[model samples]
Target: MKKIVWLSLVVMVLLVLAACGGGESASAPKESDGSASGDTASTETFTYASTSDVVGMSPILTNDSVSANITEHVYEKLFERNIETMEFEPQLAESYEIKDDNTWVIKLKEGIKFHDGTPFNAEAVKYTFDKLRDPATAAPRASLLEPVDTITVIDENTVEIKTKYPYGAFLASLSHSNAAIVSPTADQAQDLMKEPVGTGPFKFVSWTSGDQVELEANEEYWDGAPDLKKVVLKVVPEISTAISMLQAGEIQFIDNLPTEQIKRLEAMENINIEKKEGTPVYYLTFNHSREMNQDPEFREAVAAAIDRDAFVTKLNGLGVRSDSVVGPQVFGYDESADEAGTAYDVEAAKALVEKNGYGDKPIKLLTANRDNFILMAEIVQAQLTEAGFKVEIESMEWATFLDTARGGEYDITFLSWSNVTGDGSELLYPNFHSDNVGSSNRAQYSNPEFDELVVQSRTTIDQEERKAILDKANKVMIEDNAVVVMYHGIVTAAMDKAYSGLELDPNGKWTLKNVTGE
Candidate 1:
């Protein structure tokens, strides 16, 4: 709650496993109709549980994965990120041809229409992207599409786009949900946040603020109707409750499987677990804007004090130990980066802290209130204290925490940078480049050399050359202690074997169009 073969990264999001609770009502609210109920299992209905409700349905307006849980089914992108190959594949558009490094021509599929009955054509593509790039719209994902200078329609079935640069990740960026083509007719007809309109396999049914979001089969779906007639995403905040409900046959899926409960879940008679190699790197970043954190020596001392090995061990099977900034699944990863940071040594760390006089200054450790993040923050707090440093931990709600951290108000904060784009440029640009300082680059790190390397990687089309440039740039980040590389997360989920085709990708995203429940 992670690439750019159509990959985009989020500043932080866990894709929490929202599950159903037996203690809570398991049926659709009395006002609803045509939705399957968990009280009785059926082939036509599927229920997936999550810890919280989605932010909204308008794909471009929201960035969190919680909202994606719904958009993944409701929206359709011109190009799709193949969950298996991690490559960009054609979806709404039949095919694409690169005219040059800065230009691509796309041919669209005919006879396709939005859920609202609007024709899916080149005009729709231009309209959707125009809104995405409009400064007034202020779409959260607008920055990712900045590479594209303009999109011009060649015909009803074709469109040509030109980029400001070589833009290596451009095609992959098309696979993102934010790039989903929306119906101009419907978008102007209603508030998309409440009733999103798209050409997906399922239609937006109903959303009860904190309770659930329901979707039903779009019999007119361009791809053909989904096997399941109805799908429900329920909000159940407690993992323990979700586990109990799964055991009772009240819910069919748990998207975010907690590592601490894997053993217990494995013992369940009807449960099946699956793990996807994740492309996210969870790290601790020192705000370079802060005077004290600007000291490379102090940052190195902080890195040396905490033990990443033990930290990952505590993750159980949720992730793997790593010392690199980019995840192994991402294209820019190199084995040499494994030695980029200082190894754990408490005595050496203590000596460095004392020598740097950072021990007297207070280190405010900020983190979201997620269980694993808070646990790690506490663990690091103890380690830093043991190393003779003054550390204090503060936990905040996800939204507030995101704003606070991104605003560069904290000394150091935990950040889970999910490199959705499969390239090294994804891992480097937003997190380290000076241009994104007040936004994605929460670390407030700035180095002209590092910026040049990232820009070079973006303009370089050859994967080998880009990887080399990114690998070199990453060393500069690690050497400067821009952020403490911790571990790579593994996407885990548990489900009743009665359903299939709901497997999550490395980024923990799932497609429910083919999912069936019996």
Candidate 2:
């Protein structure tokens, strides 16, 4: 019966994956046929799949995962990323120079205009920054640019930004979607969720709420016009529904294609699958605020009890078991620390539990009420039980679970963090820093030394020095039982052979502005 349940789950996952796989289907424009002439003639329309609806269109409040994928096409940032190298490249800003350690002089590209016909200039840039810093706006990503002390309009096309302290990652942070510039005349009174205006290769046309969002090619774009005229983002959460849409000519591209469906799609001559190593890390976090977990020996015991190799092999076949919160893809990540080993040892876990007088304590595991998370919770529960710990599972909705976890209401919980930038500093500040406790630090773990190391790492310009600090900080976090690191996520995308030019940024965002269809 146990085998049957596992088999059933596997079969269901495969079926969902197969439905999400790509196929040659009829190409019909969803909305706004590109009859605009000029460069927009080559490509007519494109369709993409998303699992969830965008939370909001305002860059400040848009925290939903799907919003980045959709808004990226309709907005442009100061700096873009080089797809191959993952380095910062010029976009709205043609070039920038560091006048001093804490000051950046940025030169904006001339003659660039927003979709509302407002000329893009230094004043426009300053206005955007002012809006971001506005207390009333309450931008979610304000922290990313908190170092900026002031924005000075040096000239028509030049702006100078002074930071409170030297920040080595400012340029890279500009590549974030939240940094995307909007029109100066953008309706500050009207919620951007209803109407979004930006200066990108695509223009927002309409959003059908749960069904689809439509965009039209921006013919007056400063950069060359996008080849595709109309782009439609279909919200289909079920993987099977996405695959069926691809196969039945309802859509052209699907993101997050399940791994099990790869074989079936590969067999289909008309379908194409593009797989890229993803940067999302899925892991379990322990609520260290609880008395039972506050004991170092108890925490160590729990860490040693779970077999990471088994989880990686059985639960995440396409991912690597992470020994630390930082993933291998992140720049400055230390593989040596991972190689030192933290694999499961039943005897060691039992010994630690006995040494800490926590042998008979009941352990509670908390997780969001998602199918994948439930599976993971069940696996952890079984593993810890075998190691002599009494385990209980609690499930809640994603939002409730997040709030509860942040409030330190659980002993252990299945959680994941998507790295904003491909930087280790991003991982440390939000998860391990003492200041982030009761906020981003859901574990409620705190250490003054760990906090100091994090601050030092951020201000240090020397790469080696920064790395040493991060390495030490990570070790400290592990020793403190801040959280048990699990596996990094893998992104599998399925698209029809005709679709082209969809590029994945190093930050793991799909840019569809320049995407075209043959």
Which candidate leads the pack in TM-score? 1
In order, candidate lDDTs are 0.81, 0.73
What is the per-residue lDDT of model 1 for residues 200-315, given as tens digits with 9 covering 90 to 100? 98899999988899999999887778888888999887777888777776778887677678788877766678887888788998889888887778888898999988888877
**Candidate 1 colliding pairs, count:** 17
Residues 113-160 of candidate 2: C-alpha lDDT, one tens digit per residue: 877777888987888887776767766566567678999998999999
Model 1 misplaced regions, further than 4 Å: 1-41
Q: What lDDT is obtained when candidate 1 is compared to the true structure? A: 0.81
Give all candidate RMSDs, comma-separated: 12.8, 11.9
Question: For every model in order, what is the number of clashing pairs?
Answer: 17, 2
For model 2, give the 10-residue run with minimal summed lDDT: 33-42
TM per prediction: 0.89, 0.83
